[model samples]
Target: MNMSRRKFCGVGLLAVISPLGFPAFANPSARVRVGVLKFGTVNWELDTIKHHRFDAANGVDVEVVYFAGEDASNVAMLAGDLHVIVSDWLWVSRQRSEGEDLTLAPYSTAVGAIMVRQDAPIHDIPDLVGKKIGVAGGPLDKSWLLIQGLAQRDHKIDLAKEGEIVFGAPPLLSEKALSGELDAVLNFWHFCARLEANGFRRLIGAHEAAEALGASGPVSALGYVFREKWANENPDVAMGFIKASAAAKKLLADSDTEWQRLAPIVRADGRELEVLRDRYREGIPNRPLADEERDAAKLYAILADLGGERLVGKASQMAPGTFWAALKT
Candidate 1:
């Protein structure tokens, strides 16, 4: 058979045989069920993977299940309804500390930022003192902790003590900032991107705060998390999924055409779309896994100190198996 025909037949056969187990004569293609937020930014890459058949190219069938919220996805993950889920490594670390066997492969380094109206008087962290600050993700938000850590370390200013802090959802906080009810707002990356498009300026980014607090480089706050035991048993499938993910990221990084195609689903246009695309591209994790892990260890220490037992659980340091070492290549 010709190459194209053979490839088509292979895909067809794999789909048919996947549920019954691979026949001895054919190469196996594993099906990986991934759970993700319904409208999360991760969808951009996942859509790229599907559009380009990256999963099939890498010997896996990618089945994406959408969840409404992180809590729902986490519940599905723990219930074994998902083979993988996009989540923060810190939560994976906490799970591991609590005797779960989860491990994470770095996904994105895109973190939140403190935003202010373009003409707001806040010029630096110290200026945030005595201002009405709207913070998303509540008291133990990692970005908030990092910013707090930087303030305390550098200027000896306690943000939580000095500022009138109000915690709320990212959208609500963003609206409040826009309406001038807040002097500054720290919000999730996507919201920050929107705020940037709307003439808001970043007072400080989470990445900058992380760097100021001694992280070696841009550390990925989020990743594809799955049980280590499952990955070990299905090494080829795990590697294949990781490969597909990387391929999707590369497509996103290289092609504006892909972004154009994604515009509708991303539900953005003009400057908002442009800012979102650029920010997402910027957030892609390009550092070596070893470097990322090292930075994660350092940041974990800082967060543990600031967020205490509530954020990190019983672990004094990041658990050894927190980052999957097998995907290093």
Candidate 2:
């Protein structure tokens, strides 16, 4: 983690500076406040947890605050407006370095895949050289870093200069690829799943790439993060949230029929729905982060290589408490 102070405060820095005097969160009995993005697969799990009263049944009262995007959510979390949110551990790690005292829990092992057109000339990672391969998320994106690892391992090529790389929002990547404006796309799993129904071929999954590149075991690409201050004060609520999420995952992982039950959230039907369901099924994690040392190592290594100090910072390893095992039950 080679992140410097200025480079580290790259996004919404003004917001985090004010949390110093933001009134302390004084809830004697925990009324856990969580935040979420407007849409994503995590929403479905959160929904199931709510509809089934998984949180309540676990004796946790939870309030979910939905945000427009990550920036607002990050601001709120740092300001102590929210206790917990699901996100990449990179963000949590950076905040922890800055003294926010955050901790992480698992949310998903499922991740998006790299894909190519059915008739594309590229047959392997090296074939991607000099081709127009679109990527979603910014440079520090997980999928992008995973692919960089693929290149670093097999082809010994720097993908940044090796290909015509287009980075933008996820929808634009799919739209361009579908219109033949790009040769292939590395995109969100949901977007890649939809493309599969249209005859797109999977190249490699983010998690699969990390494992093949020398991770300890299968690892999740996303997880839940919460302020240690809140989690410390109300350990039961924190543990309840974890158990409830695990329960929701078990429900869905054990039954594909549960996908149809979430049709409104899936937002697709027919063959497309089937593809998404199958992709999600394929992504369920077999264990927790504590068990994925190699996977975590690869994640930090890849991010360090691709994103430099901007993402991983100067540390040679993931920050302490990046994965919260204290509440593991």
Candidate 3:
């Protein structure tokens, strides 16, 4: 049967107008993509992803992927590929101020410390002058903060101008320092212990570093994050991850046997599992972000005075209301 052009046009229009038609099939529900750091410990969040802690039978399906570092994880979040980032707090203020819809949800475990060689000419923070100081990553700001804090208290040295430090991520600095590739290095957790056993000296721990900076104890060190829009849409999944994570934290915190349980899953470059076990027991602690607005404000004030004013607006404004509220129970 030959159809007229007007009839053909009318049929095409009907296809577009049909509510219960195949056009509905074109759209698909988004799967939750979670990102983890490559060499990050067997913490609660990573364990949750590994052991399928979150339920898929509900509404949304969750998938886990590992990136080389937190920087890469942030890139994934910005690209909309990741629903959450279980990593550091440095990105929180930086991302939020940029107007990115990302928010911190809860705290993870305490990361570890910075180490130097025992016999190295450097004894105190002031000794790190023209001599090279190796950190895990080049220009590693986190490690550099230790030097900055020490300088501010002991010598009034300006980190921006007076400090000369270097950073190298994994295998690079660790391997080099072990094999005599560099002078002294800053390390974390298991790696710090390894450096000590291998004859490297302990210069400073993260907690001690914070203290020297004239601050109080164990500030909110590391934690998790999610896009604001994504978290709002999938509150169930968010809550599920948090619940599973809290459980893992309790397990790790309570017993020495659980530390052994985590050994096989945790890995570090040039560091043994036993060292990691000790680090896990001593260093990492599962704690929530505090209600101390003063400390939060202090961090912002320090960063701003240190030329990181571009990263945050005001110290008083840096509260963990939405994210911290999520961890109440």
Residue by residue across 91-188, what tens digits does model 2's lDDT show?
77777877779877766677777788898787788888889988888787877887787788787988888889999898888988889898888998
How does each model score on TM-score? 0.90, 0.86, 0.73
Hey, what RMSD does candidate 1 come out at? 6.3
Candidate 1 lDDT, 80-174, residue by residue in tens: 88999998889999999888999988889999999998988889999998999999999999999999999999999999999999999888998
Off by over 4 Å in 2: 1-30, 327-329
Tens digit per residue, CA lDDT, model 3, 134-216? 66644435545655666776787664455445666665677877877566667655567767667777766766765566555
Lowest summed lDDT across 10 adjacent residues in model 1 is found at 1-10
Please rank every candidate by lDDT, starting with the best: 1, 2, 3
- Candidate 3 structure, TM-score to reference: 0.73
Query: How well does model 2 score by local distance difference test?
Result: 0.74
- Best by the lDDT measure: 1
Candidate 1, superposed: residue stretches over 4 Å from native: 1-29
Better of 2 and 3 by TM-score: 2
